[model samples]
Target: MSILITGATGTIGSLITARLAEAGAEVKALVRQAGKRDFPAGVTEVIADLTDVPSMRAALSSVRTLFLLNAVTPDEVTQALITLNLAREAGIERIVYLSVIHADKFTNVPHFTGKHTVERMIESHGVPATILRPAYFMQNELMVQQTLRDYGVYPMPIGSKGVSMIDARDIADVAVAELLRRDRAPTALDRVTLELVGPQALTGAAVAQAWSLALSREVAYGGDDVAAFEGQMASFGPSWLAYDMRLMMAGIQAFGMQAEDGTVERLQAILGRPLRTYDDFVREAAGQA
Candidate 1:
C-alpha cells in the first residue's frame, strides 16, 4: 500500500514519514521545494504546492492512505479544501488528519479553526477518516528552554487548565497504526476522535518543574497573561501567527483543554503497548539539544 504524507519536513510529519517507511509501506512525501530534500532516500519526494489541486492530485495517484500533517500559516480556507478534494480524486481509501484538541470550538484561533474546517471537509468527502486530536506537544517545551535557562521563566498563555502534553513520536505511532490497519470497521472510521496524550496530565507549573530538572536549574512558571505572551511570540513569528497564538491561548484558558483518561487508555489499546511519557520525550529532546 502507498501512503502520502504532507508537511514532510516538520517535527511530527518527519516522524510519520520515517515510521511508515520502516513499516515497509511505499512512502510518498509532498514537498514544496524540488531541490530541498531532508528525509531518507526511500521516501518518494513529489514537488507540489499544498494549496494547488492539480499539483496535489499528481502526487496522490495510487496512494491508499494519506496522513495529513501540514502546519498552515495565514492562508485562504479554500486552498485546504481543494487539496482534500484532490486526495479524494486520486483514489485514497483512508485519510488520517492530525487535528488540535477541541477543534470544533476553536473558531477564534485561525490554526485550530483551520484544522476543524479540514476535519469537516474530510467527513463530507466520503473517504474513511480517523481524526487524531492531540493536545499541546511536549516538544513545545523546547521553545522556552533557553529562556528558562537564561532568565528562569517558562511563560504560558495555556492558562491554569492543565494539558495532557503528548510526544510527537507517540502520535506518529498511533497515526501509523490507523493507516496500516486494513480491517478497520466503518463504525471505527466513521468519526474517531482519538485524543493523543502523554501518560501524565500536568498543570503548567508541573511542566516547568520537568524543565527545571532537565536543565539542572530553576524554571519559574509565569501566569497566563495573553498580551505578554503575544509580545514574545510576535518577536519570533509573523504577526498573523502571533494573533493565532493568542486566540488559541484564550481557548485553552477558558475551555480547560486537558484530556480525560479514556483517551490515554484508548491510545494504549490501539498501539498494543504502553504510551511514552513526557519525561521520556524530554530526555531524548534534551540529549539532542
Candidate 2:
C-alpha cells in the first residue's frame, strides 16, 4: 500500500513514516524542499507544499492512502481544505487526519477551530477518513526541559483541571495501524473518530511533582498565567501563534483535555498494549538534562 504522508518531516509524521517503512509498506513523504532525503532506503520523498495545489496534486499521484497532518501555521486551514479537495479529486482511498482532542470545545483557539472546520468539511463531503483526536502531547514538555532544569518550575499553566497527555509515539502507532487497516481493505471503510489518550489524567501540580521526582529536586507548578505564557511564546515565535497558543492554554485551564470513560481502554485496545506514561517521559527528559 502506497501512502502519502503530509507534514512528513514533523515529529509524529516522521515516526509514522519510519514505522511504516519498517513494516515493509511503500511510503512516500511529502516535504516542502528537495534537499530532504531522510527517509529509509526504499521510501520515496515528494517535494510538495501544502499551499501549492499543483505540487500537492503531483504528490497525491498514485497514492492510495494519505496521512494528513498540518502544522500549526497561519495558513493551516487553507492548506488543509485545499489538500483535502485535491485528495478527494485524486480518489484517495484512505485519509488519517491528526486533530487535537476537544477541538470542538476549544472554540477560541485558532488551530482548534481550524481543525474543527476541516472535520466538518470531511463529514459533509463524505470523505472516507479516520480522525485521530489526540490529547496534549507529553513530548511538548521537551521544549521546556531547560526551563524546568534551570528555574525548578513547570511553566505550562495547565491549571488544576486534569489533562490526559498522550505520547506522540502512541499517536503515530494508532495512525499507522489505521492507515494499514484502511489501505489493505477490499473497500473503503466508514468514517471513524478515535479519541487517543494516555493511561493517566494529570494536573499541573501532578506534572510538577512528576518532574520533581524525576529530577530529585523540588519543582513548583507555575500558576495559570496565560499572559506570561503568551509573552514567553512570543519571545521566540510569531505573536499570532503565541496568542493562538495562549487561547489554547486558556481553554485547557477552563475545560481540561481529559478523556471520557473507556477512552484510554479503547486506545490501549487499539495498540494492544499499555500507553506510554508522563512519568517515564519526565524521567527520560530529566536524565537527558
Candidate 3:
C-alpha cells in the first residue's frame, strides 16, 4: 500500500513517515524541495507543494492513502481545500488529517477554524478520512529553550488553565495506526475523529515546575499575557501568525483547552500503551538539551 504524507518533514508528519517506513509500508514523502531535506532512507520523496495543484495531483498518483498535514499559514484553508479536492480526484483511498484539539469548538481561532474547514471539506467531498485532533504538543516547549536557559521561564500563555497536552510522538503513533488500519480492514476507521491528548491535565505553573525538576534549575511561568506572547512570537514569525496565536492563547486562558472526557483511554486503546507523561517528555527534552 502506497501512503503519501504531506508536511512530511514537519513535527508530526516526519515521525509518521519514519514509523510507516519502519513498518515496511510503502511510504512517499511529499516535500516542497527534493534533496533539500533528508527523509527516512527507505521512503520515497515526491517534490510537490500543497498550493501547486498540478504538482500535488501528480504526487497523489498511485498513493492509496494520504496523511494531510498543512502548516499554519495565511493560506492554510485554501491549500488544504486544494489538496483535499486533488486527493479526491486522484482516488486516494484514505486521508488522515492532523488537526488541533477542540478544533470544532474553537471556531474563533484562525488555525483551529482553518482545520475545521478542511475537516468539513474532507467529509463533504466524500473522502474516506480520519481526523486526529491532538492537544497542545509537549514538544512545543522546545521553542523556549533560550528563555528557559537564560531567564528560567516557561513563556507560553497557557495561563492557570490546565491543558491535556500530548507528545507529538503519540499523535504520530495514532496516525500510523489509522493509516495502516486501512490495509488490515478497508472499512475500519473511516470518517472517524480521534482526540489525542496526554494522561494528565497540566497548568502552566505545573509545566514550569516540571521543567525545573527535569533541568535542576528554576523555571517560572511567564503568566497569561497575550500582548507579551504576541510580541515574542512576532519577533520570529509574521505579525499575522502572532495575532492568530494570541487569539488561540486568549481562548485557552478564557475557556481552558482541556481534553474531552475519555480521551486518554481512547488513545491508550489505539496505542496499546500508556500515554507519555509531561514529566517523561521533560526528561527526554532535558537529555536532548
Candidate with the greatest lDDT versus the true structure: 2
Clashes (backbone N, CA, C under 3 Å), per candidate, total: 0, 0, 0
| Cα lDDT over the full model 2 | 0.92
Deviation (Å) of 289 in candidate 1: 3.3
Q: TM-score: which candidate is best?
A: 2
What TM-score does model 3 achieve against the real structure?
Answer: 0.96
Tens digits of per-residue lDDT for model 3, 1-289: 5999988888888899999999999999988888867887889999989998888888987888888898999999999889888877887767888988878887789999999988887778667888888888988989998889899999998977678888999999999999898755655355888888898888889989998998899999999999999998999999999999999999888777677678788889989999999999999888898
The whole-model C-alpha lDDT of candidate 3 against the native structure comes to 0.87
Q: What TM-score goes with each of the models? A: 0.91, 0.98, 0.96
Provide C-alpha RMSD values for all models, in order. Answer: 2.4, 0.9, 1.4
Question: CA lDDT, every prediction?
Answer: 0.78, 0.92, 0.87
* Candidate 2 backbone collisions, by pair: none
Lowest lDDT sum, 10 consecutive residues, model 2, at: 34-43
lDDT (Cα, tens digit) per residue for candidate 1, span 1-289:
4788888878888888888888777888889986575777688888888777677777787677778776767664566677677877776667787888888887878888888888887777666778889888877878876777788777876667677778777888998898777324343355566878877867768867877787778877887888888898999989888878888888888876667658778889998888888777767766778
Between candidates 1 and 3, which one is better according to lDDT? 3
Q: Which parts of model 2 have CA positions greater than 4 angstroms off?
A: none
